[model samples]
Target: MKSAAVPRSAPAFTPRALACALSYCFIVAPAASQNQPHQGAELPAVVITGARFPAPAAESPIGATVISAEQIRRAGVLDVNSAIRKIGGVYGRQSLDGSPDFGLDLRGFGANSGQNLVILVDGVRMNENELSGAILASIPVDTVERIEITRGGSSVLYGEGATGGVINVITKRGAGAGAGAGQASGYHGSLSLERGRFDQHDARARVAYGQGPLSFDLAAAHQGTDNYRANNAFRQKSISGGFQWAAEGTRLGMRLDSARQDMRLPGSLTEQQFIDNPRQSLTPNDHGSTDIDRVTAFAEHRIGSLELAAELAHREREVRAAYGLLFESAYRSRQTQFSPRLRHSARVDGLHNEFVAGVDLVRWQRDTSFGSSASQDSKALYLRDELRFAQLSNARLAVGARHERFEKDEANAMLGVPAGAQSQNGWSLEGSIDVAPSLTLHAKAGRSYRIPNADENGYRSSGALLDVQTSRDLELGVRAGSDARSVTARVFRHRLHNEIFFDPTLSGGWGANTNLDPTRRQGVELEGQLSLGQAWRLSGQWQHVEAQFTAGPNAGREMVLVPKNVVSTRLAWTPAAPHSAELGAQWVGSQRYGNDFTNTCGARIPSYATVDARYAYRVGAWEAAVSGLNLGDRQYYSNAFGCRSGIYPSDGRQLKLSLRYQF
Candidate 1:
């Protein structure tokens, strides 16, 4: 490895210094001149995740971020996790086994990372009701059209497990409306290949066809890597297809997806072992594999001012794991879901009113080792109303409510627990006012809940069933500027009760599921984007959070693995047509270890910063790019197990070269 002119260590800057520097940059930024385009000339792009109907970010009551496919390509990111990490108020860490799947933490809920966040694909819930989080790797980047991220408590409209936020991924199905309206018939395709360090290889292909009210899309991807550390190799293959038909005022669509993955688990290293050599493997013989398949069908019809939509989906997954010579396990799960919704738009006394109501039913069953079986059924009904007061400077008011019932049946081979049931209800209210031509003020208050999954309840025999976790949140924010330049800042506070988590101090050395006392989380997020002339752009994000146990044995102690501050900035230069380049840096603050909940161990992880750069060129139908990650070769740990074991080290400096051909 070669060193740059600057020192390898990150710059020494305290939180206060960082904040002042960023604020200075925003204040002294240059303004557009006579030759530059007007800031508000173009309307903002619309988002579909948090609003009753698709609305622009400037008009949205909730804090949201939208990432388009063009931005993903410019950033040279191969996975969804990498793309999301650049956003504010969102953080993620890979599994100890070094798999592509990532566990996300939103709003400082590190203890319930997987269960607190919600993930969706085309409005379909993808977050499994099991121990594992969403299978994000199964969806290829080439198939994604856009990703909408709503940051706040969203349970009133999205159902349970949205105490933190929601991520909705929308995939491409066809060309423009002209093609689907019988105006054109054509076929398009693209093929891409990438190679990087650690013997990594990736290949992807996509094809689409559209003709006279019918369209079809198919995509497939394969990736394999000999990872940086021992016993951390992984291979995955995924394929997806979609078909859609549109005629008159009705539309129908169907989608199918499948994925398979196999990987070796390196486990966690001890503190001394990490200092000696981070590349060493602690569990050389441990391995895991997963197979998944899913199918979904949906339809929508419009009549005058009323619209109705329905969807049905089924999914199956199989997992196998071998823990060295200790033991091997096999598990299988099947899930089915049905959703129906209705939407109506009307004018009531000069006010534009939009109403949406929906029902969701989901059933899941799992068969584990020792002949143990567990099943759950969830039913929810929700309604939302949005009123645009044309009489009051176009101000908006939105209200939503939801009711859910959950039933669990477990035939535990060891505990022999019977069936159980739980019920929850929540509501939310949001309002936005246009204080000025280019400024908007918004406030929202909401309540959300999350129920324990089978694994969290008692899948380990030593664990026991836990109560539902509930939260109340309040937020106020402001949005200024327009499409050319914009700034958004939000401050939020949340109080949670009956927070369920794994306690290593209980059940001897083995952890058990239990409810903790009251907890509190408060934070501030700031995001800004500036268009510097026609050839340059700048974007920045900063987040500060304080999460603590308000009333518990660990009262006033900060939560583990929840960093207090995160900052990121990027600069993009497109000097001319067909050529572009970008440089970015991210800084993460130090955090407490998982087992050090009491903050009495006097041990903490250190902070780290990394730089990334990408350059791309395009000509005709061919494009090529080169990207570098962790340019400083900084050593850092993204996650940890406990005080007894070492942390999970992230990958070192690496480079990739990619080529793509489109027709």
Candidate 2:
């Protein structure tokens, strides 16, 4: 699938975005909140714009948080997941390996935690359509410069899965405002190395240069672990390259991101395996590997009052895994996707409005050797509008719509699934109002529908065809604070119709999407950051979630793995020059649910908490940090699946230390 080129005019960056970004200084003026500390002890200040451009997070018209590079270093984050997990209203949970297998459950929404949320790398979508899931592992943290998280329904600005929220991973860019001519065109780069228990070894480096009218950046990194347990080893390598060009009224760029991982996971264990020996399996039943390649290009031009941008991308992924005794059965899959989009912007009066409409055409061809068999194609179109309310304290509202058509190809005879086609359509709307200089309120409600995959809808009928899956959601949020103290909270609810669950006893691999049941999720979240003075800072977030089968055949049953509560907190101290200390903790509620419908275990996953501490020291052009995770030596299962009968044990307490030098 491809997009037809259209001759269009360029759109210029509006002064409003710049104005809002600058407003942070005034809005957070010390005199306004004189009681707040300014020097002795405080949290480091951070900034972010939930929109395309940059803005101070507190002034952003949405529930958002900005995690700074300094904070990332203090927490010893190896991945974006680890950083965001420390934020409130955000929950990242996955199997032991920390692969894309993790799910992101936010604010009572995103129960399945897959594609329910949106992941953007410098404004590009990273969700996979095959399983409608996000590939978190595809992005490497070493390449990231900052992360902007907008929690709650955001389908208005973004297309789908904005149901829960949006995470924008902004990469490093050219010099900031203070740099001089020589520094502006000069070079910048860093190199780092790390070693730890479990045979872990890693090295990374990045370099960049900004010259007149042109700027470029390139980065590469590699990591490997003999792993903490038998049959649980992994290795990975990644490279990223990007460039930007600026002219009188044009800004153009392209980026290429690629990665590959070779891993071995001990297959899921039955209850007996957990009790016998958490890591004793040696039948070679646990092993898998994944390969990923992606390339994306984008261009933007600004002409007078108009702003325009275009994007195109191609990606490929392949996975091979072994399971069962002696690796008897296995699942192998390969998938490819391509997308192209165009956006336009403009301004009007005390009201600045921007329009963006585009087509996302995808041809996903997949080959699976075991379990589900299939191949398919999907095409979609979407349109969105963002309107700024200059008269209402920088308020803004946005609305968007999307439509898709799907067709399945290929069938597995033994599986009894036939080829079929399905079409799906959806629309979303959201609005935000900044009521005061220090506070913003936002709300959104939208509907999303997904046609079942070939394996779900067209499975042959020695069985029957299943129905499509549908969902509706509503969200409200408020964000208030200043440079010294900030707080953000959101409440949300979602109702899923035609819920699907695999039922092994019934027929062809279990339940179908056609099940006329309703699954409902509701929750609340709170996150806050405090800068006590210049030396002490504290951050904390809490979430409450309740998911149940409402008004359905499975009424009253709590959704599997949908934890009822999660909380995390962090503290950092930088009282003296060249020194910083940090502490962090995470708590996960109990979870009980199995892939197989029959093996339901209402057992609560014993909620567990892990603590970590870090210390950093700087000398000249070099900086060093040492850290420890799971300091209490906590032992527990990472994930539970298959009706409480199956579980995957995560690694126990591990130690990691690193050092870095910059130029």
Candidate 3:
């Protein structure tokens, strides 16, 4: 095995992205000096992105964004992946299982997306301990109430795996959901059906009942698609429900969810094959199947500015798959988790103060048909405190810390490994101040870490454990908004030590997951939304990241699969009546292909842009929508294992029509 001998051109930073970053100063000028309350309505209504913390959105030390349920319906987003991409401004690559499940990258942590970022459903960790990552396709958008995205290292609150960021998907519980809007104490039901290209079909139904202090609902969803590529068919079925009782600041709930999925793998193609017909599959008969069951119980109580909250969850997951038409295996894992936390507010020395503390206990075990079994147990304790002074223009200061320990035992029927014990410590300091009525300034510095997971530890070039990954993070940002406009701008950098990643250039191309030398990730991010007149609105995001090895063999070289520039913008006509329309465009800059660790790939993965749109009509308890994805019919490949020959081309174009009825 060898690195590609020829070199390819890299994408130059675009002027538009630079201008978008530069223009933030101008947009905040007037608001920078005016002291006033937020009097205007926002696109999604600002809220705390991370559920663990109760701080206001404006005072958050990190970049945060929220996408509401109404926004999801207007955009015709069908899954969590699509909602994250189109509305949250993250970039996602089509997964082998299809569009609904994707590998989403944030802040340029490419290739190992699932490891770097954290995904949560109702405050339960969804990320797995394997390279296969989380199962996201099965979460129907219709069941979601909102999605919260927070950027920068959040290990102090989410655990060791949150170096990139965190995304929390909140589900609807009827009754008091949506702050009591469109929800009353009564019976409710809804049904939805959809059809699209490539024989895609979907059905979803929900039934709910709410009566003073109690709300219960049940939902089921089914989806099937003969995807864009040959032999790439996917099918999924899921049923989920929950019941909640709330009254006088006390809340109690229990949720149960189950899902199954089956898909045929359509391997990769060579550069020549991609150029000729990207839709063809090299390995047509390969396939996979997955089954998952999860249950969670949660409780919260409030008393005298003191809040107590907790969640207990248990999950079972199994996957059987064949890759490259030869390798075959089955994996089964069960996880049980208990998380309890509380928030307390107090006034001391004439200043307002807030305090938070939490504990996490997790037990996970796994068994594989390939003669392997492993188990890991962890315990963590964390605390955070913030102080606010009204005399200093409502300024706030905060600090937080976390300490976690892990114990593991793993082995193979054919091979043996030593049991291990490890621990990680993290800390953060941040502050924010209201510079003007509608403008805020903030900064954060933190230290974060990640321990090697079961799968990564299983594959070793020397048959030994890998190193723990760590990073020092820094950020500076501003948030400004008014009646008709809103904007957020931030510049951040992370200096890393022992960054964990797979090295294709290792062990003579046999490939191994290993920790790399010193590395750095730095970038600029801008997000804004503007209301145009009464019926029109515009929203967009621009991001530029530099991911490079600072030392070692690949020193000064760009990391694989990390695009340097990405831009997304949308224009919408959202009148108050019967018709609504939306148009969106995304341009992703090119970067080196996966496995091109030496930065010698013959050709970089080419840059590409996609256009999508939707139109909807509604008339009393019923709505219909027509939507299209990749309307440009762009031919592109976002993933490749080693080089050009390992390319997996993305879908070209597709359309969908859906109808919904409420009763």
Q: Give the top-scoring candidate (TM-score).
A: 1
Residue 578, candidate 3: Cα error in Å is: 0.6
Candidate 1 residue lDDT tens string, 302-372: 89998888879999999999998989999999999998998898997989888899999999999987576
lDDT of prediction 1: 0.79
In the range 1-663, model 3's lDDT, one tens digit per residue, is 122212223335473644555365336444423333322224434455433854555544356778888888778877888889998889887796664788888888888878889899988898887786777776767778888888889999889888888888878877643223467768887899999999999999988888888889888999999988898999999998989988888889999989999998888888887777777887876889999999999998899899999999999999998876578989899999899999999987668888889999999999998777898999999999888897888888889999999898886636555578989999989888889987988998999888888888887655667778999999999878764677888999999998988887778878888889899999988888766656776778888899999998889999988988888888788777688899998888888888888888777887887899999898999999999999977777788776777888888789999999978
Clash counts for all predictions: 0, 27, 1
Score candidate 2 by lDDT.
0.64
List residue ranges in candidate 1 displaced over 4 A.
Answer: 1-10, 33-35, 38-43, 50-61, 87-89, 176-185, 348-350, 459-464
How many residue pairs in model 3 have overlapping backbones? 1
For residues 203-271, write the lDDT of model 2, one tens digit per residue: 888887787778877888888876545777778888888777777767677778788887777666655
For candidate 3, report its TM-score.
0.93
Worst 10-residue lDDT window for candidate 2 reads 1-10
Off-target runs (Cα >4 Å) in candidate 3 are 1-61, 176-182, 323-327, 348-350, 411-413
lDDT of 3 at 286: 87
> In angstroms, what RMSD does candidate 3 have relative to the true structure?
4.0
